[model samples]
Target: MKKVLKVIGITVLSFIALIIILLSFLLIKNYLDSKKPIIEDTYYKNFQSDATLEKKYAGLGSYEVSLVKLKSEDDTIKEYKIWYPTELKSKSQAYPLIVVTNASNTAASVYESFFERLASWGFIVVGNEDKQAGTGLTTSKTLDYVLELNSDSDSIFYGKVSQDNIGVIGYSQGGAGAIRAVTEYDNSNKYKTIFTGSAAYSLLAKNMGWEYDISKVAIPYFMSAGTGSSDDSGEDSKTSFGGVAPLSSLIVNYDGIRNDVFKVRARINGAEHGDMLTRADGYMTAWMLYQLQNDEEARLVFIGKSAEILSNSNWQDIEKNN
Candidate 1:
C-alpha cells in the first residue's frame, strides 16, 4: 500500500511540474507580445500617381520635376518624384538619381519641395511614398522600379535617368526604408551612394529583437538627426523615441571609412524629425549635394557652414540609457 502511494505521489508531482513549465512559457510569450508597439492604421486619401499627372502637365522650368508612378509585381502602386536640370537636355540628361524616403507615416509627396532644391544642384531626385506604414513601398518594389527604369532607359519615362549612377536619401521612417532598400534591393552595386536624415535605430532595435539590418550597407551614407525640438508640441514624441541615441550608437560602432561604408553626420539642438528636410539655413541639402555628387563646394557648405548653423540651433540630445 505504501509503495502504491509513493508511485501516485510521483505522478502527481510530475504532472504539476509540466503544468508549471507550460504556464511559464505562455506567460513569457504574452509579456513579449505586450512589450511591442501596436502598429497604427496607416492610409492616404485622394492618392494620385505622379507619373500619370506629370505626363499631362509636361515639363517645366530650368530643372524638370515630375511625379512618376510604378506598379510592383503584387500590383502595389508606388509613387515617386523625378527631378533633373533642364540644361542637360534629353540625350545629355544622364544625371545621378537620389531616392528619398520620408517618415514612417508620411508620404514621399511630403518631401516633394526638397526635390526641386536637390534637382537644382544637378541630380535626378526620386521620393518614394511609403505604403502600409513606413516599412517601404516594399523593398522588392523599389528594386523592380530601379530595374524597370534601367531596362527602359531609352523610354521617355526613364530615358534621361542614369540608372548606373544611382543614390538614395531618406528621412525618419523613410530613412529606415532607405536602409532596407540599400541592404536588400540595391545590393547589385546599382546604387553607389546613400543618405539618411534622423535614421531610426533599426539595427539596435533589431538587435533588441526587431530584426532590421540597415547598418550593413557598404556604401557612402550621409546621415543626420535633430538635436532638440523647435516647438513644444514635439517634446513628448522626442522623449519617447530616444532621439539620436540609436544613430549615435550606430555611428560609434560604424567601422567604415570616410569614403566608404557610411559617412554619418548628426545635427543636435531643438531639431525635430520633420526639420531634417528643412532648408532653413541649407543644413540638409548642402551635405547631400557634396556627398552625392562629390561637389567640393557643396561638401564645404555641408560640413563647414551647416555645422556652424546647427551649433547655434536649439536641438535635443538623446539620453544615454536609450
Candidate 2:
C-alpha cells in the first residue's frame, strides 16, 4: 500500500513538472515573438535592385502610414484593423483597398508592419483578429464593415476608398480564407485580384474545414509557396502527401483555375512557410500594383520577355497562363 501511494505521488509530481515546463516554454516563445520587429529588412534584402521593380516596391512607399482599430461584436472576428496612407485624411484622392486574412493563430495586430508597408504604397489595408480565419466568414464580414464605413459621411474612409479597385491576400490558412473570401461569399465579385502565400493545400484545408475551390476563381491570381522541409515533408504514397502547400499542391491549384483567367504560381527557393509572409513581399506587392493600380512599372515584373520574376534566382517552378 505504501509503495502504491509513493508511485502515485511520483506520477502526479511528474505530470505537474511537465505542465510547468510546457507553460514556461509557451511564455518564453510569446516573449520572443513579441520582440520581433514589425518589419524586417533582411527578408527583402535579396530583392533590392537599382533597375528592377523590386527595389522600389519592396521598400516603403512615399505615403506615410497610420492604423485604426475598431471593435466588433462578433465572437470570432473580435475586431478590425485598418492601415492606410496618412495623406488620405487631407488628400482628396481615392486609394486602392486590400483585405488581408490572418494566418492560423495570428491576427492583424501581429503583422501591423506588413499592412503599414502596403498602406505606405498608397493602399488601404484591412484585417481582423480572427486567429482561425480559414472559414472566410470573418473575412467577408470585415469587408462588409469596411464598405459600410466607406459610405458613412463622417467616416475617415468615406469617399477615400476606390470601390472598383480592391484586392485580397492571405498567408497559410488565411490563404484558404482569401480563396473562399472571393469565391464563397455574396461580395465575391468585388475583388479584382487575389494572392496567397503558402496557402493550405486541398487535403490539409479539407481536414481543417477550410476547403476552397480555386476553379471558381475568375480574377487575376498570384500564388506562391516556399521550398523548405516544413512545406514539403510528406511522401507521394502517404495520406498526407504534402505539408502546408507543396509544389505539387500549388500546381494542382494553378491548374484548377480556368485557362482564360490570368494566374501565376511560383515558390521561393530557400524560404519556409512562415518566411513567405514577408520574403515574397516584393513580387506580391508588385502583383497588386499591376493588377489593381495598372502601374506600368509593376507590369514589367510579371509580363513580357523581360519579366523579372522568371529570371530571379530566388524563385522557381514558375507557371503562368497570362
Candidate 3:
C-alpha cells in the first residue's frame, strides 16, 4: 500500500507538469505567430517584369518612368517605380538604386523636386506605393513588394542597380512603415541602408494593441524628427489615444537594439514635417548620398549639418560616433 501511494503521487505530479509545459508552449507559439504578417498569393501575381514594364511606360527623357514587378517565389506582383537617369554613365556602369518611401502618400508628381535632385546627383530613384495608398508608397501588407524588386529574376535591374545598394527614405507613416518593413523582413543590411523623416514609429499600432514588432530590427536606420512634432503630455491626454502620434513616446523611451542605427538629423526651429523634403540642404542630400553610395563628401555634409538639426542632448550622444 505504501509503494502504491508513492507511485500514484509521482504520476499525478508528472501529469500536472506535462499539462503546464504544454500550455506554456501554446501561449509562446501563439505570441510568435501573431507577430508574423501573412503574404497572400494574389498579391504576388500583380508584379510586372521589365519587358512588360517598358510597354506600360511610353515616354523617354532626363526623367522617364520604369515599372518593376517584384514577383515573389509564390508568384506575387510587388509594384515599384524606377526613376532612371536621362543618361547612363556607360552601358557597363550601373547606377546605384535609391528606394524612396515618401510620406506624403501623394502621386509621383508630389515628389518631383526630391526625385529630380536625386537623379541630377546620379542615382536611379525608385518609389513604391503602400497598399491601397497613393503612388510611390508601400504599406505593411506590401513588404514583399520591396523584396521582389531586389530578387534574382530582376536581371534588368541587376546591371542597372549597383549591387543591392539601396536606400529607403520615408516621411510620416511611410517612415514607420520603412522601419517596420525592414525589421520584419530583416534585409536592410543585405540591401544597403534606410532613412526616415517626421517618423510615425508604429508605437500606436503596438499600444492600440496590434502585434507589430519593430524592436527586432537589424539595419542601419536614420530618423529625422521635426522640431515641433513632439506632442505635449496634456495635448496627448486630450487627443484620441489610438492614433500613430501616441507611439512617439514609445520610440523615445524604448532602447531594444541600435545596431547599424544612426539618428543623422532631427531638424529644429520652424522645420515642419514636410519642409525637410523640399529644401535642398547639403546635409540632407549628403546623408542620402553617403548611405547610398559611400561618398565621403556626402558624409562630411551630414556630419556638419547634424549638429544644427539635433536639439536633444541625448541625440548629441548618438551623433558623436555617427
Candidate 4:
C-alpha cells in the first residue's frame, strides 16, 4: 500500500511540475511576442505575391517618409506621432490625412512601419500613444489637434492638410475607437471614411463599455477580421463568429449600416487577430486611395465585377454593398 501511494504521489508531482513548466514557457513566449513587430517581412511577401491588388499596394509607395513627435502638456494626451511625406514642406498642394487609433496596450510606435508605409503613399498619418483608445476621445482630439496645426503658420502642416480628404483607421480596440471617432464625436462628419481590423465585436464592446452604433456610421466604412482560432469564441454554431470580431458580429455591424452607405466586411482566410492589423494592408490602403485620393486603380480593387478582392483566395466571406 505504501509503495502504491508513493508512486501516485510522484506521478501527481511530476504532472504539476510539467504544467508549471508549460505555463512558464507560454508566458515567456508571450512576452517575447509583445516585443516584436506584428508584421513580418516573410508574411507580407507571401501575401503580396498572392494577388494583384496586394502586389501593387502592399509595397512601399513613391514618397520618402519622415516622422515627427508632438509632446503634450496634458497627461491624458501623452504624445502624438506623425508620419508624412518628406516633400510635404516643399509641395504646393495639400495632402490628405489619416488618423490612426492604437490597439489595447499597444502604442503607435509598435506600428511604426505601417504608418511609414502609409505616409510613403503621400498621406499624412497621425497616431497618439493612447493604449486605451477604444473610447475614441483621444482619436477625435488628435484629429482636432492636427487640424489646428494645419492652420498654425509655425507648424509644418500649416495649410498642408486637405481638410476635405480625411480618413481614420484602427486595429483591435482601436478598431472600436475608429467607429466611435466617426460617429460619437462632434467632428464625426469631418471623416470621409473609416476602416477597422479585428475590431471588438458588439457584445464584447458593450461589455467593455466601448459600444458603438454602426447604423450611425454615415461615412464610407470598411472593416475586416481574421479566420484564426484566436478570433473564434467557440460559443456559437457559427464558428467564424466566435473570435474577437467574428463573421456573425461583423455581419451584424454591416447589416446595421444603411444600404446607401458604402460598407464592406471581410475576413482573411487564415489570419489571426493580431495578424489582421497588417495582413490586410493592401485592401485597407487601396480603400483609402479609392475614397480619399480617388485613385482609379484602387477603385478597381473594390468596384466592378472584376474586383480583385472578390477573387482573392486569401480572403473569405467578403461582403460589400455598393
Q: Highest lDDT: which candidate?
A: 2
Which run of 10 residues does model 4 get worst, by summed lDDT?
40-49
lDDT per residue for candidate 3 within 169-224, as digits (tens), equals: 66655556566555554444444666666555454434432223555555555555
Model 4 misplaced regions, further than 4 Å: 1-46, 237-241
lDDT of 2 at 130: 91
lDDT string for model 2 (240-294, tens) is 5577888889889999999999999999888898788887888899999998899
Best TM-score among the predictions, by candidate number: 2
In order of TM-score, best first, we have 2, 4, 1, 3
> Residue-wise lDDT of candidate 1 within 138-178, one digit each (tens)?
54356456557756756454665666667776665566666
Poorest lDDT segment (10 consecutive residues) of candidate 2: 41-50
Clash tally for model 1 = 19
Model 4 root mean square deviation, Cα atoms: 5.6
Residue 45 in candidate 3, Cα distance off native in Å: 41
Separate clash counts for every candidate: 19, 0, 16, 5
CA-lDDT, candidates in order: 0.51, 0.87, 0.48, 0.87
Q: What TM-score does candidate 2 get on C-alpha atoms? A: 0.88
Report lDDT (Cα) of residue 198, candidate 1.
66
Off by over 4 Å in 3: 1-79, 131-158, 186-189, 207-212, 229-254, 259-265, 279-282, 303-320
Candidate 4 per-residue lDDT, tens place, 1-322, comes to 9999999999999999999999999999987876676655334455544687778787788999898999976576688899999999898799999999989988776667888888888899998778899989999999999999999999999999999999999988999999999999999989999999989988778778899998899989998999987775656624334678877888889999999999888889888987877788888999999999999999988886678888999888999986
Return the candidate ranking by lDDT, descending. Answer: 2, 4, 1, 3
